[model samples]
Target: MEGKDTDQIPLLIPYKLGQIRLSHRIVLAPLTRFRSYNSIPQSHAILYYSQRTTKGGFLIAEAACISRAAQGFKNTPGIWSKEHIDAWKPIVDAVHAKGGIFFCQLWHPGRVSDQSFEPNVGQAPVSSSDKQCSPLVDGGVEFKFLTPRKLNSDEIRPIVDDYRMAARNAIEAGFDGVEIHGAHGYLIDQFLKDQVNDRTDDYGGSLENRCRFALEVVETIANEIGPDKVGIRLSPFSNYMDAGDSNPEALGIYLAKSLNKYGILYCHVVEPRMEVMEERTECVVSLGPMRRAFNGTFIAAGGYEREDGNNAITEGRADLVAYGRLFLANPDLPRRFELDAELNKHNRDTFYSPDPVVGYTDYPFLETII
Candidate 1:
């Protein structure tokens, strides 16, 4: 889709975002490609990320599991160990060398995890409640999730501490900042959604209580690495991993209002149209109200075409637009958007393949084809 001709296209404009100044409003969204093996980032990751880096561009790295217990997917990277930190250092440095700002996304899968992928084999996943959902299978049919063990009150603090330590590890690995992956039915999302969080303790039940786990993790990460360097990703209406909120609109506004006090760098929200891990619902809540609630920079993602992204930024709905699949297929996506060039379609088959470079760093630049 072509962007409308205008004197100023908001997507191409430079903006100052927190401590980092962005050259354009296009952000590379965090995507799980399942390329890392044994929870360690590989050499191809450096090439993949650097290929997408543009001067002053913002790139949020794929969600890195905060601890061994937090892992859910196969071959996904983590930020828990010193070895992991060392592995990520070169990737971060490569992006920085190209003048791109990189943020490591801190993640925990909670009840969404599979026993085979868990650090302790044969152990069930942990979550706010003892509910079960389907575990992700590569090129296979979905399977039922093992009933997760409910996190005890004493165990909650340690999980929060894991996020704090992960934030420190991200900084030590040369990341410009850390983004708390509180969205899309992950560990944090499990706590935020009432459908999943059935606990009567202080960490569940009421909206404030349900949101406590998310808040604590964010606050701890923000405190560990200055709030100016912290950002969060949220998906209120997302039904992913069986995480559907009773009142998505109210939940979104409340979370935004609460996050306002933290002075975080940005709030990255998934647009209502895209379905992450579940079937699309008929009910769609507009992100307009939530955008207004948060005073910081707002990033909108999911199913955005060139024109749609430009319009969202031009209409004042979002300060920036994040592209996932489009960026994956087009390494120089920002330049393509600038010149209104044709976008290479992403190959769905190789998206999560374990291949080192088939879909990782093989996408050609516009100049190469020209």
Candidate 2:
């Protein structure tokens, strides 16, 4: 933003991502707005995603639970049924209308969930192990976590199929692709991170074993759809939701190499724990090795700004950089970055509000603000 010509900006450089030739390198990181009520995407999302669409830009939708049992928090979208697929069709079309490439992020909360968010008659939340998450403390009031039921050897294939089915549902709903939510201590991460995965079965113990479940999901989804239509988000360096690994760098590189076997679209890796999901400082580990190991396009996310993003691309650290909060507040994020325009400060309080227009689509575009 400071030193060079706007035309020379690395973020503005066009790059081919698998099948699509993108107009820019900035991606809209999947932000879970919690605005989809009753587990169904609402009409309001049309304006929300459409406002952010730029010709040939990429946007990953918020985490859509693979099944009813996968719903961790309230009001998140689901893709496990035909009704859900129909609901997403319009929203997907809205982005496509503007020539934007949209990818649905499929996820399962696993142990991060509680029975309270379940559909009729609550069943126990399942994970790789029976260990429960520690209660979250907020203003001295605690929300305790129930002991999650451990998945038996026989039950793993069904959940793997859930991911495969969700990916197919997303494509049926008119999405360009599906990104597996393998990051953020979700179902896949619960198995990848050794801290939570205490299984003595084939899914635990050795690093390769811990990664088996994730690979299965990737392979199933790739086969169900196609490898070019698949991507997986991973954060081996993150300790969020109590899913930290002992050797994160190794974990990161290993997953990157493993993913090459399927030749998925891209690897979206978050910054280390301290920089993840927050405004940041530098992290101890660098993503260079992971980026190098990943044969497909590599997207680096978490706490990146215009200058930082440009630097990452220029330095060949990543093929693309994702912006979460920035994109949330500034729908015309790529244009704003191109012009070095001032960004509207985001209201953190209303970020997760259920109101459709409050902090959701009310953020003005660059033209209106000027």
Candidate 3:
């Protein structure tokens, strides 16, 4: 995929995070395509992710639900079924064949969900408390309120077990590791945010208590499949889904410290966003505090381009960088960086639709004439 101008581009470098040695610092972040609307991913879904694999790069698979009740957006994939695991096997195997590492990002969307997308027999999304999410109905429908069921002390144990089962499924599917989706104002982030979590139990009041569920899930996943094969993603202070923790600094520090104790692979954080007209402006937050808290590797995502990714590594703020939409538009993203090639613009219309081969995996890699 290298271009004629590749010689002018800075030399791409290799880096190491714990036991995982990356040939390049670039990583493909989890971007939700929603093409796999059904609970099970099809063979085409396998081809989509497999096509993006490059030598020693990392692929964090799009958010796969931990359970049926956790399904949120239409067409999103899940790991709750045997068919799901079977469907993903070829994708992970293909990445391995290319000498790349793949991680299935496990998630539960929680109250950020609609009843229309609920699983066949599951209840409305469950969260740390019974709270209604800011309704932004996906398909141009009139917005409706979602009163999610709250998990009690007894009920919490099973959901935690679901995470463990999902982790086991990831390994069975041939993934190198598993990434817990604790970011983007989803289930785990809902638990961390005081505005969403209002219960009086240990999982509600203080910052430590608010992070209890996340800690439990991380610890459980690490225990299930060695800490080296587990990682967690978090959006500390962003309101991507109307989520904000009472004390972001404290929450970040505490969670980072707890994760370090597990000796997991890394912690991926989404940088803060500022609204600018119709679009949002992304800025890098100081990673100094979090770097101190987590002794393991750290990755930064959200609006990071090649130069920014390089800068983040140069500044010692991040060990690696994750690209979401950029990777969507440019499948050979690392090569694009290596050659300083102009990227293909993403078609926003096809981002979430169910049509196959449109936005799913149509991006062609750049080829050069020797």
Better of 1 and 2 by lDDT: 2
Q: Relative to the true structure, how large is the alpha-carbon lDDT of every model?
A: 0.88, 0.89, 0.79
User: Candidates 2 and 3: which is better by TM-score?
Assistant: 2
**lDDT by residue for model 2 (226-253), tens:** 9999999998988877898999998999
Residue-level error in angstroms, candidate 3, position 125? 1.9
- Over 220-310, each residue of candidate 3 has an lDDT whose tens digit, in order, gives 9999999999989997867766788767777788889888888999999877663312266654556568877888889887777788777
lDDT of 2 at 117: 56
Model 1 scores a C-alpha lDDT of: 0.88
- TM-score of each candidate structure, all chains considered together: 0.95, 0.95, 0.92
Best-to-worst order by lDDT is: 2, 1, 3
Error of 2 at 240 (Å): 0.4
Model 2: lDDT of residue 62: 94
